[model samples]
Target: MPTKPSVLFVCVHNAGRSQMAAAFLAHLAGDRVEVRSAGSAPADQVNPAVVEAMGEAGIDLAHARPKVLTTDAVHASDVVVTMGCGDACPVFPGKRYLDWSLADPAGQDVRGVRPIRDEIERHVRDLLTELGVETEGVETGGVETETEPRA
Candidate 1:
């Protein structure tokens, strides 16, 4: 059996995008990947709107925390995904990195944040493929995960 890959998603604040990404990762990857998410600056709680949107998609992230990003999280992952962190994210060698330029959902309501949320879902779907997680239904947005390790 192929070994499960470990992944970390990072954002400025763990309240929105990263939370959603982490939720999708956990949902689609299931038992296939060790997934986590953190933020350069974590908020006290998850953005409620994000939680609601994810809930609508049949995923529950109510237990997800807004964790502060640490060097340990970076060291623990083979792949680190960043969104809107620019220069605040840590750098590590011998690991793959991906930057997702999705808009921040900090202040947006569900209607306004849906586009960003959908984009994240698309990216998450593609990421699952990259990690070799088999899943159907691709009505999220547009991103695609890696199917195999890059050659």
Candidate 2:
């Protein structure tokens, strides 16, 4: 049997974007992928608005806490995704690195967080595809469609 690919999501706080990305990857990829998340400077807890937004997507992050980034984490992961963490993450030779430019959801309300959550989901789905993981049985919890403004 082939070993599962591991992915690490990193950000400055790990309270919002990284948490959401990790949850989406775990939920979507099931056991096919190993998901981890951390921050350069750890926060006390996951962002509440991020949790609520994820709840709307049917992923519970209520118990998730911010974790400090470590070199071991980067070494263990096949892919390392950074969300505005800048130079905080340690680079490894064999790891694939991706930087996602996303809005911080720290003080954002649920409404503000929803879009960021959805965007993370999209990126996670794309990553799954790249990793040769199928998302067929996963429930996406429905991303809201934007209506075009009539001129």
Candidate 3:
């Protein structure tokens, strides 16, 4: 890893799972890790239910927008995490790649998106552990546990 490891989160829409994962990683890792998120087919806006779910965790995604996946992004990242983007994501050798089998949160309500948000949190926590980044005041399996929020 570089002095600061960079991670890219990719999904099909970049509107839900990838957005949530990026937000969680950014919140937990702070500036210790560089976080980026993109979609295979970018959407116009973030999924509203995902935004609400993240807000429930005390993190905001209200202004988050979808980003396009690019080979340059994959090349720049030390770790590339794919959430159901499959072939849409570019593969480059020598980069750590992880594919998270997460449910799409596009059309779900806050009730349905909560679990997915929690699952992404868990995975992001695990990834932080693997990257040797320590988070403060974040509790696993609890939606309300938090510290300061970040964008």
Candidate 4:
């Protein structure tokens, strides 16, 4: 089989937006893509509201943790998506980079996080299509095993 396309999502804190985006990508793309997420400045844990939001979509993110961004991660990925990470994420030639200006779910409740989660799902779906992966009726599940929460 051909190698799977890899994506890395980065944000200031891996606590909210990035976490949701990463989870959604994995849930939608399954094992067809290599999903990874990290923070420019790692947090102790993922934001509680983010965990709850993902649970609503049937993906458990309670076991996920924040990871510090690294050059290796940027090098390994075919795409590097930034979410409010600014200049923290190094830019490399030949890598597809996208900056998603998503609202931070840091202090928001589950209700407030829902919209952010939905937006992320839409972005993830579009991304899968850009990668040439079919999303028409793919079975959805947590792609956590293939993703390293602390990468």
Candidate 5:
């Protein structure tokens, strides 16, 4: 079998946006891609809203938590995606980097978090396509949609 490509998503808090993106990628890729997420400044736990939103999409994110970014993570990934957290992620010499200007879902309610959820899903889909992975085609449930929320 071919070695699975790995991806790392980074953000300031790692509690919301990046976590959601990581979950989506893992789900869509279905083991064809290795997905990980971390924050420049780690939080104690993931945001409840993020969990709730993902759960609605039939994705379980309860096992996920905020993690601090490490040099090893950057080195391990075939692709490193960074959110709005600027200057926190180190520039690794040989890894591909992508900056996603995603809105933060830190303090947002479901009404507010909807758009962010949608954006993440879209990005996830595009990413899977780029990686040559097939979409899971599962209903987004209550968690996934096309909307943007305040950060």
Candidate 6:
């Protein structure tokens, strides 16, 4: 890993899972890590439900637009995480790759997207640990826990 590890999140559509994952990493890792996200087949806009779910967590995705996956993106990152993008992502030597078997958030409502968003947060936290990034004292966007009641 480089002094500041660069991570790329990829999926079939850049609208939901990848977007959430990248946001969590960026929020949690801050400037300690470089984060990027893309899709094999990019969506025209971000999923509305995803935006709402992330907003509930206090991280806004309203302005985020889907981006297409590129070979150069894969080459530029130290780690590449794929979420249901399957074989669409290109493989290159010396780049660490991880495939997260996450559900596609397409057409899902905010309630349905909440769990996926939290799950991505967990994974992003683990990834930060693996990359030796410290997350202490970082203010999270207030993701709700299972036992917490929705306001």
Please tell me which predicted candidate would have the highest TM-score against the true structure: 2
Q: Which stretches of candidate 4 lie over 4 Å from their true place?
A: 139-151
Error of 4 at 38 (Å): 0.3
What TM-score does model 6 achieve against the real structure? Answer: 0.93
Query: Model 4 residue 116 lDDT?
Result: 77
Clashing pairs in 5: 56-143, 115-147, 115-148
What TM-score goes with each of the models? 0.86, 0.94, 0.90, 0.89, 0.89, 0.93
In TM-score terms, candidate 5 sits at 0.89
lDDT of each: 0.81, 0.89, 0.88, 0.85, 0.84, 0.89
Best of the two (4, 6) by TM-score? 6
> What is the per-residue lDDT of model 2 for residues 84-116, given as tens digits with 9 covering 90 to 100?
998778887888999999999989988788888
- In model 2, where do residues sit more than 4 Å from their true spots? 145-151
Clashes of 3: 0
Q: Where in model 1 is the C-alpha error above 4 Å?
A: 136-151
Taking all chains together, the TM-score of candidate 1 against the true structure is 0.86
Order of quality (TM-score): 2, 6, 3, 5, 4, 1
Q: How close is candidate 3 to the true structure, as a TM-score?
A: 0.90
Question: Candidate 4: worst 10 consecutive residues by lDDT?
Answer: 142-151
Q: Model 6 off-target regions past 4 Å?
A: 141-151
Error of 6 at 36 (Å): 0.7
lDDT of candidate 4 over 47-112, digit per residue (tens): 998897788677789999999999999999999999999988899999999999888898988877
| Inter-residue clash pairs, candidate 2 | none
Error of 2 at 78 (Å): 0.1
